[model samples]
Target: MKKIFFLYLLTLFSLNSYTQNLIWFIENDKFGYAHKTTGRTVITPQFTFAGYFSEGTAVAAVGNHLLSSKYGFINEKGKWLIIPQFNAAGNFSEAKARVQQNGKWGYVNKKGIFIIQPQFALCYDFKEGLAQASVKNNLWGLIDSTGKFIVQPEFYSITDVFAGITCIQKNITDKWEILDIKKKTSIKTNFTRMHAFADSLAPARDTSNKWGFVNTHGNWVIQPIFTNASSFSEGLAAVEKEYGSWGFINKNGEWVIPAQFDRPGYFFKGLALLEKGSDIVYVDKEGSLVFSFKR
Candidate 1:
C-alpha cells in the first residue's frame, strides 16, 4: 500500500509554494527553489528530484524515481540536514517527515530520529495532526504524531484530511464515506471519485462520470456537468468544455476565463500554467498570457 509513494512520485514538478515568497521548481531534470515574486533563482537545480519545503525542509533524491536509494532531507540553503540513506522520503510536515527503511515506512523528527519505528506498510506526511498509515498492507487507518491509531485500521483507503473531515472507503467497496475527524462520524457515499478538498469545496464524480463541487456538508455547490475538472485554487478552478478547451471558473460556476486554452492548470499565486500548442505559457487570473517559456 505504498500508494502514498506512488501518488507523490507520479506528479510532475511544478511551481509549488514553499514559504511565503518562495516556490519549488525543476529545471533541466534537476529540482530547486526560486523566489515566487521576482522569479529569481534562490536555490540552484541540483537534486535529481525535490519536493516543496515544509517546516523549512524538503525531501530530495539522487537518482531515478523507482530504483533510487539515495533520499534525504535538505534545508532552504540546499544543504543536506539528513544524509541520504532511506529508500524513500516524504516532505517534512508538522516537523516530521515519513521515511522508508528496509522497505518499511516510519516518521523521523527534524533531527532525523525515528520517532515512530519503521513498521507500517505505507505512511504519509501528517496533515492536520494526523497521517494515513497501513499495517501489513491491509488495515488502513489514521495515526497521530505519537504513532497511536486515532482511527482504527479498517478502511480500504483513506483520502487526504481536510478541514477536519476525510472521506474513506470500506474494504472492496466502490462507494466513499466521510470520516469526521472532530465528530468521529461513520463513513458513507456514492461518489465514483472523491478529490481532495480545496477552497472550502471538494470535487466529486457522479455515477455518470461528470464532475462537480460539493461543500463540507456534502451539498453540491456546483452541478456535475464539466467533461473534466480540477479542484479550486485562489477562488478559481480549471475546467474543460465539450471540445477539450480549458478555462477557469469561479466558485459561482461562472467562467472567469472563457474556454480557450488547449489545457490549463490551477491558479497558484495569481498565475496558472496554460498549454498553447506544444509550448508552455504562464497566464494571469485574467487569462492573459504574461510569460511564455521558450522550448
Candidate 2:
C-alpha cells in the first residue's frame, strides 16, 4: 500500500512539472505556447485566443473574429481535446470547466459533458471545491461541485475561494468581509476593502486607503503602507510605492525588486511581466530581463 501511494504522488508531481514548463505566447494575431525556460515554441500559433494550462488542459478559441470565436480545450501538443463548440470557456479547475451555451453559463467535465447545466447568468472557475455563481447580474453566491447552492445568492460580489476563505460584499455600499465558507461564519476584520486571497495572503486596503497584506484570520500580516498592492503569487507581489511606480515585494514587505517599472505584475513560475517606458518585458526573480514582447 505504501508503494502504491508513492507511485501516485510521483505521477502527480510529474504531471504538474510538465504543465508548469509551458507558457502561452502570441505571434502575429494568433496564440500559441512555448517552453518557459528556453522560450522555444512548442506549439505553432494558430488559435485566435489561448489561456494558461490548468489541470492538464488549456482553453483555446478558433474563429474569424473574437466576437464569434468558439472556445475549446487543448492538450500540451496543441491538439483539440474538446472540440471548439462553446461560445465561451474558462480554464479547467477541479476537473470541470465553465462553459457558455445558448446564453447561460454552466460547468462541464473534461469529456465535454455538462455536469452542471447552463443556468447561471454568470459563473467563475471552481476553487477549493466551490465556485461563485449568479442567477442575476449583480447577485452572487457559492455553489458546490454538485451545482447545489451551499451559500445562496445574496452578496453583491464574491471573491474567489482561497484557503477555504472568501471575501464578500453584501451590498454595493457594503465593505468587503472575510467569510470562512466551510464554517459559514464571518471573520471580524478591520479592513475596508479586500481582494481575493492568493498564496495565503490577500491584498487589502485599510480605512486610510493604504494597501497591505492580511492573513486568513483577518489580521494584518504586512502593515498598510503602499498606495496600491496586488495579491501574492509564488512568494512575491507587485506593489505600487508611488503613483505610476510599481515593484515586487516579498511576504515580509521588503522590496525584493525596487520600485522602478511603470507597472509590474505578480510572479509566476519564477518570472514576472513588467512594463518600462513603452516596452513590455518578462523578468526573472532577480529582476533580470528574460525577454521582451510587443504589447
Candidate 3:
C-alpha cells in the first residue's frame, strides 16, 4: 500500500542510534563533505551548504545566492543520483518528497516529477498514509499521498498520528483533543495540554499548570501534579516538580527516580541524556547514571 504523508517528523516508538551518513560544509571558498559518523572526508568542501542524506540522496546549495539555490540528490558514494532542479526541497518520505517552486509547495516522486500541485501554504513529509497541509487560514488538516484531502483544513493545530489517534486543537480557546480518524469525532478531554494517547496513556496538564498522565478515555490515571512533563517514551517520561531539577515518572505516577537533574531529555535507546550544572550524563529510567558525555 502507498504510504500517507505526515504532519511533521514523527518519532518512532522504538529508539535507535539515528545517524547522518554524510555532512556538508563550505570551506576554502568551496563546498566540502565528510562522513559525519566517521569524520572521513568524502567530497571537497565546495558547495555553499549541504543537507543531510535521506533515502540515499541529499540536496546542496551550490552558489552564494540563497535564492539561487537548487536541489540535487546524491548517493552514498557521493555520486549524483538526481541532478538539482527544485528551487527548494525537503527530505524524501513515503517514496515522495516535498518541494517548493514559484513560492508554492507540492510533492515530487523519487524521479523528480511533480506528483502533487503547489496549492497549500505548507506541507509536512508523508508518514503512515497522510501528510498535513495548511490552508490560507493557516489551519492544518491531513492529505493523502496523492494530495487528496482526507481530513479537511480545519484544525488550528495537530500532532502526528500516534498509535491510531491524532491530537488536534480546534480553536485557540479549546484545549487539545484527540481525534479518531476512524470515528471522525473529537475524543473527550479535560486537560488543556495533552499528548496523543499511546500505550493506553497520555501526558496532560491541568489548569493549575501541573502535569500528570491520563488514559485514552480521558480519565486521569496519574493525577495532575508535576510542574513540567513530557510525552511518554519506553514506559517512562521526564518530569519536573521543583525548580531547576528534573526526573522520570511511570504510568502510575510513581517517581521511578528522584528529581535531581538540572534538565532531562526524553529517553531513547534505554537511556536518557541529562544535565547537571555544566555536565551531561546518561541515565536509566531508575535514575542511576549510565555514563557522562561531553555536551
Candidate 4:
C-alpha cells in the first residue's frame, strides 16, 4: 500500500509538469521576451510585438504596419520557424492555434496547415478539451479543438473554462450561470451577478448588493454579507464593507486580516496590491505591508 501511494504521488507530479508555464509580455509595451527561470529574458527585446511562448515557440510581429501587423513563429534563438502570414494569431495549444484571415478565425496546426477552415466571428485559445467561438448572431459557444461544436452558440458571453464547466451569461439577462458541458444543465444559484469561479468558488452578488461565494455545487459556503468582494485566490479573498475599507477574509468568511487598506487587488503570488490615497503597497495574508511601489 505504501508503494502504491508513492507511485500515485509521482504520477501527480508528472501530470503537473505537463501543464504550460504562463509567458506574458511584461515590459512597457507589447514588445517583450519570454520570462525565464533565471529571472532573465529568453528572447531579446527586438521584435515589434510578441505573444506568450507555448510548445517551445512564440508568435512575433515584424515590420512597422501599425494596423496590419503580421505574425510569425520564433524559437528560443529568435529564429523565424514560420514566416509571417496571419493578420492575427493566438498561441499554440494542443499542437494547434487559431489564426485570423480576412477578419474570420480558424485553426492551424504547428506546420501552419489549416486543420479547420476560417469561419467563426470570434475564437479563443483552447483550455481543457474545448475552445469558445462566436457566430454572427453574437451568441458564443464551445467547440472541440477539431472545430466541432460541443456546445451550440447560445450564451451572450463566455468566460474561461474551469473544472470542465464554463461560465456563461445569457443575452437579455444580467445573471451568470455555470454550464456543465457534459451534463448540459445549468447549476442553480441565486446570484444576481457572478464572476467566473476561481479556487473552486465564485464571487456572487445578492440583490442587497452584498457579496459572498458559492461552490460549483450551487451551495453557499460563505453568506452574502460584505459590501464588495473579489474572487478567491491562494485560499484567501478580499472584501469591503458598505462605505467602509477593504480587507482579507478566509474561506470561512472570517476576517483573517481586518479592513485597513483603502483599496486592494486580488491576491497573487502570495500577496495583494494595497492602495491608500496615492500610495501602493504589497501586503501579506496578515495585512502587514511587505513591499511598496510608487504610482
Candidate 5:
C-alpha cells in the first residue's frame, strides 16, 4: 500500500510538469507567448497583438490595431488551430467565440466555423451557455448557443450572466435590475449604481453615491459607507475611504488592513499588489509586506 501511494504522488508530479505555461512576451515589435516560470519561448514573437490562453486557445491579430485586421486562434504550442480570417475576434469561451464578419457579429466554433451566423450588431462571448447580443445598437439581450433569444432584446445594456442572473440597465431610466434566466424572473433593486456579483457579493452604490457590498439576494451585506469598493478577492475586498485612501477588508464588514495606501490591487495567488509613493509592495493576507520593489 505504501508503494502504491508513493507511485500516486510521483504520477501527480509528472502531470504537473506537463502543464503548459503561457505568458505574453514582447520581441522586436510583436508579442508572443513564453513559459510563465521558465521564461522559455513557447511561440515566437509574431502577432501584433496577443491575448492570454483561454479554453486551450489564444487570440492573435497581425495587422493595424487602429484599422481593419484579421484575428484568429493559436494553441499553447504555437500552432494555428484556426487561421486568421475574421475582421475582429474575441478569445474562445465555452468552445465559442464571437467574431465579426463583413459588418455583423456571430459566434464561431473552435474550428473557425460560424455556428451562429452573423446577424447581430454586436455580440459578446458565451457564458453559462448564453451570450449577450444586440440586433440594434441600442437594445441588448441574451442568446443561446443556437442563436435563439433566451431574453428578448429590449434593454439598453446587459451584463454577462453571473450566478445564474444578469444585471440589466433600462433603456431610459438607466436603472439596474437583476434578471434570473433560469426562472425568467426579474428582481428590482434601489441601488443607484451596481456591478455584477463576484464571490457571491456585488459592489453597489446608494442614492448618496456611497458604495457597499451586497449579497446574491440584493441585500446589503456591508453598509453603504465607503467612497468606493471592489469585488472580494482572496477573502478580502479593496475599498476607498472618504479621504481617497485605500485598504482591504474582510467579508464580515471589518477592516483587516487599515485604509492608508494610495493604490491597491486585488489579492491574487496569496498576495496583493500595493503602491506606496513610487514603490511596489506585495502584501499577504495579514497585511505584512512580503516583497517590495522601489522605482
Candidate 6:
C-alpha cells in the first residue's frame, strides 16, 4: 500500500508540471491542447471549444454546436475532471472557476462544487483575489473570493485589479478614474476609455481618441501616440500605428516588432498570437514565428 501511494503522488506531480506548459491550439474548426515548447499535440482536437489550462485544468465543450453545448473541466490527459453541465465556464484561477447556470454567474471549485453560489447577473474571473461582479441593472463592483463585496456594487463598470490598482466608471456619463485598492481612493484623470491594469501599466485613451500607457497614479507613462493599444504583458504591449497594421512595443514606446500583422494579441508564456492575412500564427519576443494554425 505504501508503494502504491507513493506512485500516485509522483503521477500527480508530473501531471501538474506538464499542465503548466500546455497551450490551446485549433485545427479543423476544433480545439485541443499542445505542448508549448515542442508543439506536440498532447490532446487531439476533439472539443467544440477549449480554453487555456489554468491551475492544471481547462474548460472544454464536446457538443456539435457551441451554442447548444455544455461546458466542463478537463485534466491534462483530456479526461473529464468535471462533467459537462455549466451553460458556460471559465478557466480556473485561485482555485475557483467562474461558471454560469440558469443565466447567473458564480464560482466553483476543482471538484465542481459551488464555492460561491450563483447570484451575479454577470461576472469575471478572479485576479489578485478579487473579481468583478454585477447585480441587477448592470452595476458592477469588486468581490472577494468568498463572494463578499470589497468595493460595493455602485460603479457602472470596474476593471480587473492589478498591482493594487483598478479603473472604474461610476455611471455612463462619468469619466474613468484610477482606484487604489489598498488606499480606497480615486485618482483624478480624464480617461475616455481604459482597460484593466497589467504589468504595472494600463492602456488608457485620451480625449483625442489615441491610446497610451498610464501608471497607477493616473499619469501618462507613455504618451498617447498609438491609434490603438493593449495592456502590457510579459514586458511588451500590442499597438497599432495604422488601422489595419498592429505590432509590439516595449514600455518605452519603442517598436520591438514592426507594424505588419493584421491583428495582434498580448504575449503569454513568451508567445503572442498574430494574424497575417488569413493565417493565425504565434510569434516569440523577437517576432519569429513559433507556430501557425491556418483558419
Best by the TM-score measure: 6
Stretches > 4 Å off in candidate 5: 1-20, 25-29, 64-66, 230-250, 253-295
| Model 1 pairs whose backbones collide | 177-188
lDDT of 3 at 94: 72
Candidate 6 residue pairs that clash = none
Task: Give per-residue lDDT, candidate 5, residue 218.
Answer: 82
lDDT per residue for candidate 4 within 168-224, as digits (tens), equals 778756577777888888875566777667788778888787888988876788998
What is the lDDT for 257 in model 2?
89
Can you write out model 2's per-residue Cα lDDT over 164-271, one digit (the tens) per residue?
Answer: 889988887777889988788997666777878988999998889999998988888999999988778788888998666989899999989888887656676777
Q: 1-295, model 1: which lDDT tens digit per residue?
A: 2333323442432323355655555566566777766778898988776776667888888876546648898888889999888888888878888899998999998888999999899977787899889987487888998999898888887766788888787765577776788798854667777766778888787889888888877778999998778778899998888848889899999999999877657776776766666455667889886555422
- Deviating ranges (above 4 Å) for candidate 1: 1-17, 63-66, 243-247, 257-295
Model 1 TM-score, 2 decimals: 0.81
CA shift of 47, model 1, Å: 1.0
User: Which residue segments of model 2 deviate by more than 4 Å?
Assistant: 1-18, 261-264, 274-279
Q: Candidate 1 vs candidate 6: which has greater lDDT?
A: 6
lDDT by residue for model 6 (28-62), tens: 76888888778999899999777767788888888
Instruction: List, residue by residue over 155-239, the lDDT tens digit for candidate 5.
Output: 8878767778888887656667878888988888887777656677878888889999988778889999999887677688888
Task: State model 1's lDDT.
Answer: 0.76
lDDT of each: 0.76, 0.81, 0.67, 0.69, 0.74, 0.83
Better of 4 and 5 by lDDT: 5
Q: Sorted by TM-score, highest first, which candidate order results?
A: 6, 2, 1, 5, 4, 3
All candidates: CA RMSD (Å): 4.2, 8.9, 7.4, 10.5, 10.8, 8.9
| TM-score of candidate 5 on Cα atoms, chains taken together | 0.75
On a 0 to 1 TM-score scale, where does candidate 4 land against the true structure?
0.68
Clashing pairs in 5: none
